[model samples]
Target chain A: MHISPTPQDFLDQSLLLIQARPKTTRITTTYSTTSPSLRAKKTALWLAKKGKPTPPTTTTISPPTPTTAPTTPQQHTAHLTLKTYDPVSGTTIQFVTREIRDVGRLVGVLGRAARGMGGVKTQPDTVMSDAPVPTPTPTPTPNQAVLHVAEADVPRVGSPAPTAARIGTPGPGGEKQQQQHQQQAGGSGGAQGKGKKKKGKK
Target chain B: MHQQLLSNEEFFQKLGLLFATTTKQELGSVFLTQKRLTPYDQNPEKSDTKPQEDTLADLALAETPGPVLVRATNGASKQNRDTKKIKFSTLIEPDAVDAFYVRYAEVCKSGMTALKKKNRRRKNKKKASKATKTEGASA
Candidate 1:
């Protein structure tokens, strides 16, 4: 039941982040910072003749609502862009609009590559065999995250857990969740422990 | 009401017959495999003749099919049968282990060849294993 982050959350979170900012000069972590998907994309793009600098990778693509036109990635299309008041007072950090389609395409490609890795790519007929079983959904996402997002040199998978915003300590019951999680194991995994105890009692 | 009741009876009888036919079709391979492998049917009339004929040839072929397991009064006699139905499946035991491994290796080689086109890095695997990425190029 992990709900994806909606558009408004991005704006709200950005505002909150800006508000919390000190008058600190943000050292722009250049594209040089390690990120696999970004490097892979750049490498792949360069390999494909797309050239250097893959889309300035974003942790979130706030699904644009009807009103906002769009934001472009530094290299590709960025759906939602965030530029803060420059670290210095009175100056602004501005980024050119990026294309959404580019980011989406790369995300899709990387997701596919990450998904198909290992001996995990079952033949279509084999996949059909698992259709009757209720368990295959969770099997793919985590591996995708681990390989692409968490892997060293490219932390594309390090982007927030796609389900982090909704089923979290974010809503009204945030504290209650924190308490329950701490009392148990913490988080979605901990949430299952309660069911385990109930079943154990039964 | 009397006419409807008669129709219902006729319909149920037809449905039952249809079910029997479909079940045979669905489980036909499984039943044939069982018949060939299991000796519970010492009574020849109970077993189908086609499977018995194929079972011997099936065993002698490249892969041995499943054994017909029987509960004998004294002990069981298992004649290793060659098979066609479950050729891709059917685990190999110790007796046929070496032969199975050789066949399996060939199959693996063929599988690798088929995968070659889509396998981005297979040829590079040898070099990739010895590959080092200069460790800190960006640094």
Candidate 2:
């Protein structure tokens, strides 16, 4: 059976190193002659920009001179190094390589792995632990509010006027019904009068 | 002395063995370096005499194929100074570099035995919880 090494064992055995450097390629170009016509055109444009009159075309143009300059182009390469040590044989070995792509993702993975093996606590964990636990405050639900009102008004359950007054204010349909009832019993005034009398008696 | 180029399989096997032998007390670190490769023509004067087409072709041919160089070293500690230090460097093909990273990452994440132990503990906990539920229902 192939037994896999533990993370701690792997951490102890190996080290990873990723280094980034800019690779520069230099290319030298030799120009045998600068084009006389092109140079003259450039001179004419410069004179115009400077608000000066253009020179006559009859003026002799200088011959092209040979010039050489080296141009360098730079690109980035990531070098990855892995070092491992053997305890049984007492031998240490190292491996190094350069990679041109996916350097960011590779570094991120390796960082996470190293932190895991080292048992390093991350910032987010410490922040979460230090934060206070939010205590839930009681919020009055619609049903609970109704129940509380009902309980308080239990003593006045025998009086219909007070009960109707309280219920009619909450519901539009109940208020309409109360209004129609008052209109039908024009002599009795309204439930409001009865609610007032009940309050007085209490 | 001539250095022998190790095949990919041989390199991986040696890497695995090295990892297998390392103990927990040792420290592991990773250093990443990125750089650009610039190709320089040695004979600029000679190239000037050649045709423009030939120079262009030469530039194309001179372009170096980017190869990843990997070097591994083991046992450089003060305590292990008496032991022999083994160091090997190899050029890895670009296509195979991804495989190497994946393997290295896997080894770093966790060991197979540790995962198995965790799974066994979880199973035992589940079984115990089930037995308690059955006992409560019976009582």
Number of clashes recorded per candidate: 25, 43
Candidate 2 deviant stretches above 4 angstroms? A1-202, B1-5, B23-65, B73-76, B80-86, B98-121, B135-139
lDDT of 1 by residue, B45-120 (tens): 4434565554343334213223211110101124632321211113222233334334423332232121113333
Candidate 1 residue lDDT tens string, A48-118: 67554455545454532211223211221112222323232343442221223222332222222112211
Q: In candidate 2 chain A, where is summed lDDT lowest over 10 consecutive residues?
A: A22-31
In model 1, state the lDDT of residue B7: 30
The TM-scores of all predictions, comma-separated, are 0.13, 0.26
lDDT of 1 at A36: 32
Q: Which 10-residue window in model 1 chain A sums to the lowest lDDT? A: A23-32
Q: Write the per-residue lDDT of candidate 2 for residues B33-120, one digit (tens) a residue.
A: 2112225669856755765655355334333334444444453566756544544545545444455556644543331111112243
Model 1: what is its DockQ?
A: 0.01
